[model samples]
Target: MRNVGAFACGLLFGLGLIVSGMANPAKVLAFLDLAGHWDPSLAFVMAGAVAVAGIGFRLARTRSASILGAPMQLPTARRIDPRLIAGALVFGAGWGLAGFCPGPALVSAASGQPRAWLFVAAMLAGMALFAALERLAAVRAQRSQSSS
Candidate 1:
């Protein structure tokens, strides 16, 4: 039941992205072209999304469990640290360059977009690299602890 609900939500989200032109790299790039022929259509879409998410988060914060009977796992981090800044910079750079963030990239990739496929592949490689580096760090930390 949970899997079905998740699939349904994901499908709806993908459809929304497609309908909003977010799945199209050209449209996204046009939106990002602030100095050039800027398209402000996506700003409305983003504003609407932010508004909805804000309300949802507010409501979620009052709840101990999700509507699905699962624990409500929300982000607890509030401080903007160096890691957060670096991550935001990397994310912004990728989005600006490729014109496809993770969600939209996944939608476009599923629709067989070549550039989206490349983006998703690179995204997966980055995730893998990060995981490997984290593992190496953990191993070094463990070794140091054991040696001491």
Candidate 2:
């Protein structure tokens, strides 16, 4: 049942991307190019998404727990941290350069775009790098404890 819901959600999200012209990198890049041949169409898509999520979250907050009876996991990191700031900067840079984030890149890759493949490769590399750094930090902490 959980898998089924996840599948349905993914399908709906992909379909929404296709319908919204977000699956096209050109459209996305145009939206991002504020100083050039700027297009504001994607702004509407983002606005609609934010409005939906805001209202949905508000409704959900009125309930004690989720439908699965599990508490919602919300981020509590309000203070700006170097790691958080660096990660956000990296994400924004990737989005600006590729004009395709994870979702759009995945969708475009379905159509066999070589550029999408490149973006996906770089994105995966970034993810792997982050994971490796986390493991390295853990190992360093262990070594420090042993020495002390």
Candidates' C-alpha lDDT: 0.95, 0.88
Error of 1 at 126 (Å): 0.2
Question: What TM-score does candidate 1 reach?
Answer: 0.95
Question: Per-residue lDDT for 1-148 in model 2, tens only?
Answer: 6677778888898889989988888998999999999999999999999999999888886786666566776555689999889988988888888889899889888879899999999999989998999999999999999999
Worst 10 residues of 2 by lDDT: 67-76
Per-residue lDDT tens digits of candidate 1, residues 1-148? 8888899999999999999999988999999999999999999999998999999999999999988888999999899999899999999999999999999999999999999999999999999999999999999999999999
For candidate 1, the clash count comes to 0
Give stretches of model 1 more than 4 Å off: none
- Give the runs in model 2 whose Cα sits over 4 Å from its true position: 63-65, 68-71
